[model samples]
Target: MKNSPTAGYHTKSAVLFVVFNRPETTKRVFEAIRIAQPKRLYIVADGPRRDYPGDVEQCKQTRQILSLIDWDCEVKTLLREENAGCKNGVSSAINWFFEQEEEGIILEDDCLPANSFFKFCDTLLEKYRYDTRIRHITGCNLQFGKKWGDASYYFSNRTHVWGWASWRRVWNDYDVNLTKYDGTEVKAQLKNIYNDDFVADAWTNIFNELKAGKINSWAYPLDFCNFFNNGLVIIPNENLVTNIGFKAGATHTVDEESSYANIPLIEIGEITDPVFFVPQKQADLSIINRDFNIEQRRVKHNAWHRKLKRWIKSKLK
Candidate 1:
């Protein structure tokens, strides 16, 4: 426990902080969370890859980072025997987390969340514990609109697992293996979710990689499961967390410089009401960028280049 606030709903719930080998980022995130000082903290440290010189060193450093959490809160650690990679590592970690508690918050090593984020997650988790319709309570606001309406967050078709919290009931539905939904069955729904052709194609490629065992994953499949079950994820009006893990040892993230250049920020406002959904046709990228005052020109340009490379690769194939 770094320091306790005026005592709110956070102390009642469990918070599972998952970290891998990135000790620096892990240290910062734990430092941030330590401020909130929840009652219980579950730290899951992923094991390192074999035959890699830095693997064992990174694991040791990661453990050291976990030790930095100053809270006397029931701190538990799950150390892996062998490298399970990010997919298995996170998947196993979250599964273990849910098994311990009915509900909890999840924070990754590189994500830096605002102080209010813990309160936001805890309040929503307690409020919606019985509501099976809500699959996740996310801290990252990917698409919150300007006008504050019925709820603080809007329901998103895509599940952005940046800094999020959820219950065991919702996570129990997650299948990392993802045996359901062959290509033809969920084609239209997939198209709806990824309205942009480039984005859709990228996701398709990722799914293919997962199926072919090229890269193992659980997040994307968890997203698919959420949608399939008609479950909603509550997102904050303000972007509470920023991702700092864009360098080596990261499986998905590449091009570090371009990734963090003009990161978007969200404007926080009062969320007096709770149950709201952005209308079906209200998810315009331009409107969202304008509302948030986000300088997304660079991000759009990067997306264009990514699409171009994908297009060229497709033509070559």
Candidate 2:
């Protein structure tokens, strides 16, 4: 893997782009991929829902944007004639991709990756291809400013799928039907892993909702599969992908002011071996706190205190 100083860094790995009716974000992400100029590019798109009034037109526009790829590359498309919803659409598209390719980078419409993201994923895809223990390599680094160690990346129990890469060996273990795991047994297993009843109960409740047909998501089930198999994800030292899909018309992201929205992207330098290949307990705990709303509450409380102080100062003036 020699870097060409003139042409810049390019990846030999296949790239999979998952898109639907969001042309605005798709254009931005596609531009980054064009710079990488992957040898093989796979486009997976879901049809517009017949019930939504303007969905069909938007979906068409999004697909039309894909025609901008003017480079000499092998392009394959999997366009659904009918809508498959988010859960089935994304999971099936990924399953189809791994069937033909051993491993590749995956990006959604809103997950805009940095130029280095492709190279980061390509390097790890080959490094851990045979190591079943490391199942996923994610471009998201949610630790804020904290670095787990001197390594360029660290292993995490949490799977961040905003922009990620993985092998067929791990994807083969994906099980959409989570009802097979008994409720009592599943709770016990998660409790052992987290060593906290509250954290385990929170995740168990979400899984129960998914099994009970209350929630529509593809990522959570993949997370469940990873944890159940004792698998780990490679998380970079700095965030490489920014999610810009928290606007209206989105399926799940309706928050106009989400904290995770528009995270800054950082270039990952040369990959270095970590001092240890283990999950950082403190960092994982930070994720759990953020997930359980504890961190959000703390942020709100601090904001309120600042507002109160400003009000008192104005009265004194």
User: In the order shown, what is each candidate's alpha-carbon RMSD?
Assistant: 7.0, 7.6
Assess each prediction's global lDDT (C-alpha) against the native: 0.71, 0.86
What is the model-wide C-alpha lDDT for candidate 2?
0.86
What digit string (tens of lDDT, one per residue) describes model 2 on residues 2-36?
Answer: 33222546888999999999888999888888888
Model 1 Cα RMSD, Å? 7.0
Q: lDDT tens digits, residues 1-317, model 1?
A: 36443442244568888877788888878776777787788888878778787878887888886556655678878887688887888988999999999998889887887777777787788888998777787777544335334556666655667788889998888888777766554556656654655444455666666766777667878877876787777766667777777775577665587434224545344555454543232443433344333345448868899999999999998
Clash totals for all candidate models = 1, 0
The top-ranked prediction according to lDDT is 2
Backbone collision tally, model 2 = 0
Pairs of colliding residues, candidate 1: 1-71
